[model samples]
Target: MDRITALRARRAGIIEQMEAIVASVGENEDLTAEQQSQFDALRAEDDRVAAQLSQAEDLERRRAAAARPAAPLPGVTAPVAGQPAVPAQPAEKGLTFARMCRTIAAAGGIPHVAAQIAEANGDGGLFANQNMGSGPAGGFLVPEDVSTEVIELLRPASVVTAMGPRMVPMPNGNLTTNRRATGANFSYTGEQTDIDATGYTYGQVKLSAKKLAGIVPISNDLLRASSTAVDRMVRDDVLADAAQIQDRFFLRGSGTDFAPKGLRWQALGTPFATTHIMTMTATPDLQKVTNDLGRMELALGNANLPYTGAHWTMSPRTAMYLTNLRDGNGNLAFPEMQDGQLRRKPVHVTTEIPDNLGGGTESEIMLVLPQHVLVGEHMGIEIAMSTEAAYKDSSGTMQAAFSRDETLLRMIMQHDIGLRHLAAVSVLTGVTWGAA
Candidate 1:
């Protein structure tokens, strides 16, 4: 069964045990110390289950709201000519993300408070299943609409994600897909000739959930604000921070027990890391620069890989350098830069690819087939707010939230990334294509 159903059953079992313990007591007889302790433990466990269930139900609500159509507003006027009708706003009184966070924080991270806020905003169904969504420092699920906003923000900010990689659902936190390992042998056979038994080889690609979490302390006043500007401001804050962090991991993460293996790590080892991976030479020669670009594509092309979904990625510095490259005749070296493309494919530039490789002056360029990048998503973003929690900063110094009147917002996402085919990536290291 799914987590929510299991939790519901577990909570029911705990409730039955608690009832039995209460029944063991005689009329007007107080429970023994052990009984009281057991009861308290069961109560706490129930609360935790209820909290998880509440969040799961919230996620279900968001999913339902996202899937179903919004009810039309009563007494609303018709749209103007030649203009698409504005769909009714989904949330009432502008139940913006900031407003939800403010409500939760104001309630001191109480989940029932979220239920109250949802009800007040005409969304009684948000927590109708179980209302204790916040269990201590645990967080609430981001609303579906807001979660969508996060995705919109994620694009253009996260280079890999912006390219629209293949999304695979990991509902059970694990997935395995069969990948073709070899082409089937084929040969012409006459009508009476014995047919040769040949079959395509296959391999398995596995994905498991990995947790990515981030914590930030926001000004209490920020969450407490009533203006819609606060909503946009806080959303932007999350967008900028989340984009950078996600891109960094997606680009250079060491595939360990912690973070999912990124493209850089995927490029390592095998023939790709050596021969398939190209090395760059610094020069202002227009032909030479274009030659280097050709070699990168040839690495995959020689392997019979398709070029349908190919794209280029480099640092901003590399992109600007290539954009302005000029030969002695003053003609642009790569004219496709005007169309936001390179080598006739789209380009994504991010600073996550460092320039410190090879004596600290070199950077790298990546040409990728976006379709080969697989993202296994377990769930959308989850957020928890706390007013009394203490957090450690980058310096490992503890910062007290209550002391500073700050709200600690912790966000967690569970997902993993993999390459459907490692050969789909080509990298050029020690790149000085844009260097003077």
Candidate 2:
């Protein structure tokens, strides 16, 4: 075996042996001297193996990096005599606010330039006065690199983005795409027979942009702290909240008011209809789950939907219960559950799927082909700051005027979600774990 594989195998063996040694000693009993010595020796060996594995992995990574060709620098030319040589691009590094600003500026966007101008002018733009660093008001814009780092730190882990849906950049107010329900057919003819008209149905799905915004209040003191520190804190908080709201609406939104129509709601409409909804038997157990999954597969097969890249989505509680279930032979009912999958399909666990539905305690489990899900997002986020503002109180029942010492930051993002094909999603409703 290769060095890395051999090291990993050795580590696994050591871990197994350690587990055996621990099990040999009764729960309430102490290990004998010999046993203790053996344990210590095994631990030391394990540590050595782990260190070697880490080194091997690092070496492999370096080798891979060295093997790849360097990317050509754009807009960079050979240096002339008397002029300093243009520096080669540096290695990939973590995100920073300064870098973010430069990138934004490079894109010819207004936000990055505005931030820089605000910082330089000391006009109290996007950042607080103190965070602007030792600078006259006229040169206050945070460094592009610093802004890049801050933006990187604020990025939120996105489930919708992870699913790899078809992303359409909606620059206009609305986007419309024609979807074909059927295709034209051709057949071989012996003679010059009259051609028959092929029947095909087409429909359009219109996705209109919906706005999601969050307002954050920060004390002047906190805002005046290190711009990096304050930017990190505020950006993370706002983006995280926005990501959660987006994910929730993308999965279960009813498309009311400002919310986008999500997968669950779209599956209930025409083209998909209720045929994709599968109801479990009286007792919802592991066997029933497996059976329902089989039924779903069959339904999709009959509908001629490809099963590749399909995934299962359910609540964490349901997943935990299913993973812990044992068969009649005391073997794991679903051995692959440890990998967060079912029947070789990836499983996504999210609380967005409500547990209280049909029976007030029923949860939904769905099989979805992410490629059929269409998601649209506006490219950039807009951020504005206000020192004098009226904000909603904690209860949201009353408006409170901001104190002179406080500042309010408002962030706005726009996006929408829709399905290209309803049959590509099938849901199992009224599912419950354990005994009926």
Candidate 3:
């Protein structure tokens, strides 16, 4: 039999023996000393065989994918004489951020474990220059493919990205661009007569990296049972927490010293609030709600902004309200709502839009020109781990990782959001359509 088959067979036998040992004990009766030792040895053997089987399966998948011929390049009428065309690099199936985190934790948070893991997975040349030095703040730089996957996965998880804004790379951790402040005056003038001069002014739109960090405490059991499933669980949990926090700052940040100025703050800056802020004076009906959204569009349209890339942002509660609202003919007022569009523009529903603005019974709706919204990110996600550090739990109680036998995986991302034009954002406030 092949090595893989033999390992699986061995693991099955170990499981059967372990089960028999457990069955030997009566209900509510403990195992004898001899039986306990035998079970422990068999359990260890099972874990070893499982690891071997997992590695073999991963290698088989890689081999199969590699064996497939590369698809022919489109629009290639002739071949180049110098050399063969380079194939597109794929995200490696071997090294992942979660797998890297597992290595670091298993090695007691040593950063160089990343390099060791990479070398063992036939990627020695790829990570040959990884930093091997150790320091407190020093952490493993995640593989490029893994970091790219994390960014792509963040799109569906983050409303800011799901809305399809302009993504800007901030390698230097900061960016600045011109924002038009006023337009030049134009009027009829007499031929050869002295003409009044008018100059269009400009302001600055700046984006600076802000540190966002989250700690995910993983069960120690995963360390012994590492696999692709463990990787997915770690990646998903981190994505959910990271996106939720990012949406909060991207939508409602008060432009404080600690947080980036969000869409609402940008609208409340001045001219937008005066012209674009639509207030709900009464409980919304089909007509009132439709009119409110219409006025919001007009607010931007009147400013000469096109609805080509305009998008809608509201809370889940508000979306359902519109979905349930019916017209005079007893048909859906917004029939296309189920397809995630309002007025034919894409709609992004997120709980980040507060429903308790005034008197704990209000919400806000934002119509934005996505192209005018910029999300600048520095280097992607970086990971660090700690086995001896103490951190506060979700309930505000302090817990030690070493004592709990859990690993604290700390993920840090640096990114910031800004608007090239503040007028590109319009908000409707004090909405109580679906208030409880």
Candidate 4:
């Protein structure tokens, strides 16, 4: 029926043959070297086939057990807040990548010790290439642990702010003086009479005016630096989260191990890192995922940290993956569309992987109760900022007045979307810069 079944059948035949060989060896005292070699080869083949069959059978059993319907524990109601609920379907095999590098000039070395007993060894454990994860002294590989690290927030860097414009009074208006050549060499009769020193005073007093200038608001470099730093710090925190998750899998373990890739260190210390760029194709509803992320984003906005700017538009595909979610009705609820579309309700959510590098890292954090799963639980999530906008209030109009014409102009300050590990920590990147 299967390779395993076939192998078992072949092994049974081999055993019979091996028995005959044993009988012959006893009766004849000695057999030809060629026959003895053949017997030994056959015995070895039989053992190999038997092992394969046993392994196949074990796999089948585990699969069957996993397929069995899960029964809820007696009296276990709602899952505690902040924890992802266990998936009713076998935990979807998932992978996360993490990368950790030193932002400082030097990083300490990671300590080594005997590998953990649970670590994958020379033979492939839960994943392939177990050797790749091994470190010197058979210890697990990990980011160099450091006692002191920089917290970009505390640094002088911050968002730029305009305390309106400073006023330098200018001479109100332009002045022009006309000095008529009253007494020219060829003047009119009356003028000629005035030409004589006794007739009119030849000397003239001329008046000219010089105007004082105005002072304009200067660009705040320090504020820009601070905003940049805030963005970098948030992103670094996210990267750190991914790094922590990766560290947990330093030793051999199931699922894919994520490593940071395409890390771009831009000016102002902004670090753009993405999870291992692997794509998974599934029926994961994108719309539901979008709504969930939007709610969180709105919460961040309401909390006052809207750093990301217009550049933070999320992809429609990513939105579809995020917005449609299970609702209070315990039914698939699309944020935009209240009613369920397809018969398949949103059972679980795989947060949209954030794109467009920003200050914060996407996390598998957040607990959401799904309608389909018997145990309402939180699921790991990916997040990205869709868009960020900002406004300042100077002239009650939320606009700044420039000195150029002493006119009030509305200025929309742009910022980048920033993700925070928690709502309390989200400081919208670059939204409000220079201190007023």
Candidate 5:
């Protein structure tokens, strides 16, 4: 049996033993010392077992809750909570040229032509057609299922998305929700007297969608050969571009020129206060690391926040430095690093966190409560294909139309990030690798 069951059985056995001892004593007679001692010890064991059982049950319940997905927000359906909603699955079929044509037709919003194009292109007619170009006759919309699969593949690769923030769906361009600015105060009052009003401090967290787009070119020959290959290629290319950009901006982007307000900047603002910012006294060593974490715990405790679900985020370089530190006896200072957790909390490493030292060149370690971070995403990705359009290069220079011979598949994604509670985040700055 599981731990909970075992504990219950042990508690029940203790109770049975206590009852038998009690029954042996007469109603008017007190128990002998030996008998009383035995009964007392059994009762104590019973209490201890009961406490353990309670704790085990609580943990079990939390595990169950975490495994279940969050409920859908009222009146919203397309974008579910926590993760983007994927479109319904299409019927299963073997990978073939006809299948590719059908997907393209559905995505192009002409589902009626799926069967006809599939039949004609079963042996590769669509990609070989001479009329194929950027016009309506050439381009097809990617089917809903295909687009959904790409998104599913992208979710795991995104650091911000994998962190499990409070996902809010953006039905429109923006969303706003009230947050607790201050908690209610309690005071003792005389009977039959009116009580003073305990005002509640409140603030708002507003999220506005920011658009991110990327373009990928596909070879005409590859598009006709295997649908599976094309699907994987498109998914990987789009995800590679989007994940890096999203991770960088979501962690440190300044709220300017349509960019989302990032976590780093938001944590430095109001309600978080200077106390939330912990600085190491010296270079990163076991003593300093312990001290810094203690301060962070104290800050969170003073703010009346629980450490549950809190985690640390830093650069992989910083993690490597910490994990490599040796004690005076040459033993590893942080053996727990091997398990990817510190102080029983998870550690997330991302390159987005810089590793420069002192004078604003310092690397940062963050203690984050995921529930306080809000992420909003538009329902689905918008895709468009073009062959003749001249696209601007990454350097902001325009490329000549003649230089582009492949079809450019443009993907647009909209999302936003906000902090529901600033106190739920803490940062440690000026952290360096070793002794200066």
Candidate 6:
């Protein structure tokens, strides 16, 4: 039996012995002083045992009371291992920010931030700051091309617009030809060429639009995904560009003059290389994009995701992504964010599209611009620094860290594509001046 049950049995036996002693004492008429003293000692011992039993009984009662079932929490489900999981209610939607992060991580993307916000504003519509990161902002939504079928899904393909190292071949006529009968003259030639695929690629997908200013601050966790995506695009795209192709030969860093986009550095006070300027031609393949998104969803769906805006949009270049900041060592860091969150943060990273930079139907601007504008030129870089943690410390000092980790770079693609495509593209590639 359990300890409680044993204690009860012992107490019952003690009570019976006490009662027998009391009865014997009452029946005896003339007891000697010695007998009386012995009886009194036995009575004292019995009283002590009774007090111990009372305390034990009280403890047992309390434990039994505590073991009773409790009414379940309204929306919450019964806890497993004494901790409740996501709620069971439909409105509660069972989706958790942590789970979303896991899903994004599974997708080979980073899920930096995840949290739920107020569902509505003072006006009663769902509040815009309801999600905090790039993964599961609200509930999980199926990506456009994801399928229950196996073998059909794949990760997004990496494209390298540049090339790797190589050597030029001599003319075929110079090698092993009939010099007498065919009357061919032969000569040998060897030429060395450098293949430099040092530049990165940036792409955009559109999303729904909503004003988020003064509604919520973009958390540090959410920014991690973007930082990671930029890094992956840099590394993979760089390697891909380095690989030589039959039609397009690879270029080298030494060949900066011929380098695509002149080693596009995100933000530098001056140009790094004049030869790196290269143009991009979009090869639109709908099937490829669908497969990429499907893979992204599959990878992220299994992770704990941070809160983020459900809609997402991507662009090759924007102002928030163009600024270059340095440490004491002068290393590069690029500041960037989606337009909606940028507006909410108001950190001087982005500008109004049509403000001082006049002449645009679009409504966005790059908060950071070159001190001197170069007509028909866009600066480029394979990878740029991203903010690790930007916040005021205990001393009220604003502190931040650069995201130099490549693993983190590959993790940022877990943003919600469904939400991102709804908004119009509003990045300012050029500045406008007021009417002269």
RMSD of 2: 26.2
Query: What ordering of candidates by TM-score runs from best to worst?
Result: 1, 3, 5, 2, 4, 6
Model 5 regions more than 4 Å off: 1-149, 192-194, 217-224, 357-361, 387-407, 434-436
lDDT of 5: 0.69
Superposed model 3: Cα runs more than 4 Å off: 1-95, 112-129, 132-138, 143-145
lDDT of 2: 0.66
Q: Cα deviation in Å at residue 259, candidate 2?
A: 2.0
RMSD list, candidates in order: 9.5, 26.2, 14.5, 32.3, 29.7, 26.8
Return the TM-score for each candidate structure.
0.74, 0.61, 0.74, 0.16, 0.64, 0.16
Runs of candidate 2 exceeding 4 Å displacement: 1-156, 186-195, 216-224, 227-231, 386-408, 434-436
Q: Candidate 4's residue-wise lDDT over 338-426, tens digit each? A: 33122222211122223332334222212111110010101121121101112243253442323221211111111111111122211
Give the 10-residue window scoring lowest on summed lDDT in candidate 1: 91-100
What is candidate 5's CA lDDT for residue 408?
59
Q: Candidate 1 versus the native: TM-score? A: 0.74
Q: Where is the poorest 10-residue window by lDDT in model 6?
A: 413-422
Error of 3 at 381 (Å): 2.3
Clashes of each: 0, 30, 0, 54, 4, 69
- lDDT per residue, candidate 6, 219-320, as tens digits? 234434443343333333322322221012111111222222111122222231121121111231333323332333332232222212112222223333
Which whole-number lDDT from 0 to 100 does residue 351 have in model 2?
74
Q: On a 0 to 1 TM-score scale, where does candidate 5 land against the true structure?
A: 0.64
